[model samples]
Target: MSEALVAAETPGTGIEPVPGVSGARQFWRRLRAQRAALVAAAVVALLILVALGAPLLTAIEGQDPTTYHPSLIDSARGGVPIGSFGGIGGHHWLGVEPQTGRDLFARLVYGARVSLGVAFAATVIQLLVGVVMGIASALGSGWVDQLLSRITDIFVAMPLMIMALALLAIVPSSFPRPVLVTLVIGFIAWGNIAKIVRAQTLTLKGLDYVSAARLSGWGTWRIARRELLPGLAAPIITYAAILMPVNISIEAALSFLGVGVKPPTPSWGQMLTAADVWYQAAPQYLLLPAGSLFVTVLALTVLGDGVRTALDPRAASRLSIGTGRKREAKAAKGETEAGKSASAVGKAATEAGNGTTEAGKEGSA
Candidate 1:
């Protein structure tokens, strides 16, 4: 069998291992080991798929969600009910809204698209701004670092929600598109991430590899990219994962305040708003979207925790140190055995020399 095949078949039989596993494989293995993280990831993926396929699913039932269907009210009044909620039957799995009798399920599915899209876009923007700004501040010394630090402090001190509300109040109505909302949230949310990146950069910039790169005539950008950035992978990924939930919450809050994606554009926050009146009566209306939001947030959080634990170099170093100590102890035993053999050889040589001298003296006599 091939070496690779043999390794695959045999438990713990493989090529010589390194100090740490390869990044991608290690991440996957760690994520899989974390049951909660895996479950959360699955739920998020399923929700995304459902949102993307909403159109096809809605079409199969032969109902137009946007169009007003008065027949639904008649069926509701009759109390016999034609559909799930006396509406359009299986076509509307979540029942119709009381006001317009619109398919709630369809709206919710469409809303998922908006919510996820906005959150993802915002997160990307935040990552870009925060990473760049942080690296710059950390590497730049004296006045530049001080200035950037002060700027970060200013942003961090501001009340984020209130600031968002104020900006929304002044902005034109046409600018409430998903992209715009993402940009707005991203800009404001970068402060915390920037601080994290800055601290990481400061630590990495002083590392031996970074200093070597600088001495080799590499520029600051090159050193940052080649020497510093690789070490930042764990922190960057963990932070990004943690940030997703925060961005989603921000979008939802904005939506709740009537400043988010407008009506007909379905968003989880907007859906929650629409269901507020019926929340006490039909709690499912509120529970559905809220539950989804909760699951997504929880999943990201767990995933972050898994990443943090898996990628922590200090923990890995401690494990390696323990392993090293065992090897050292074995070496010490081998050295002791060699010492005993050497001592015996020396004693035998000494006795042979003494006997030879005695024989010489007897011969002389």
Candidate 2:
């Protein structure tokens, strides 16, 4: 017989080994089981698509972000859109801006490109700096480690928003606003990640495998690349996912404050800045960008949480809980059926004995 068959036929030794799944597969399985998280992932994906294909989408709608249609605005009422819902109609799917009469739909998708792009770019910078600093601090000697630690503490203690505002205000207007915002945010906001990386690196460096690699005379870079990076990836990814939404909000806030992306480039925050005064006259002008920001932030937050849960081996998955509940229900139903069967059997047996007693009495009589 084949070894497989023989093993199957044997007792403990014959049991077939269950194939182990890859980490990515396990993470995806857990993530897919969460309906809200899955929906959020879909929404995030759609937003990305919208951001990437902004030009195409706008072209399809036959609208442009910069072009102003003054005719659509009611001059009598402080430049409110002529029609209801912010002048939403066949020509403008979302509606027009209050005074400019610029297509909101076109600007929205383009704004997504700026907002998400900056967030992603800034996150990349933060991650790179954080991971390097963290690894260096953990792997370095006593003095090296102390220096980096002190620096990290200083950064942690600093007020980030004030620093960002000062830096942004000092920068020359000749510099590109989007790039300036990205650089400022990326450089200033890496302290938390650095701290997290440092803690994780310290813990990981003491593990057996890391020590083994060190004993084997692996260079620092080699050890980091081969031994440490694999261990660091999960936490790094989890943190980055959570950090992106914050970056988006920060970028939006800066723009709303007039320091972010300039006019004509289009940004959600910039749109809000313009729409603030017209909230009552044209609520759609305010609502469109606000709703988009809300949805984007909400989706990102949910997706990030889902990722964290999926990546954490110790965390109980919702899917497992659901399945366990189903199993328990099935067991309870089976027990109930068994109980009914036992009662029916007892009733029949009692009836038989009673009949026998009556028949005996009749015969004796």
RMSDs, each prediction? Answer: 10.2, 8.3
Q: How do the residues 95-125 of candidate 2 rate in per-residue lDDT, one tens digit apiece?
A: 9998889999999999999999999999999
Q: Which runs in model 1 stand beyond 4 Å of their true positions?
A: 1-20, 63-65, 74-88, 313-365
Top model by lDDT, which number?
Answer: 2
lDDT of each: 0.72, 0.84
Report how far residue 233 has shifted in candidate 2, in Å: 0.6
Q: List ranges where model 2 is wrong by over 4 Å.
A: 1-19, 316-365
Shift of residue 364 alpha carbon in model 1, Å:
45
Worst 10 residues of 1 by lDDT: 1-10
List pairs with backbone clashes in candidate 2.
7-14
Q: Model 1: how far is 121 from its true place, Å? A: 0.7
lDDT of 2: 0.84
Output the lDDT of residue 32, model 1. 62
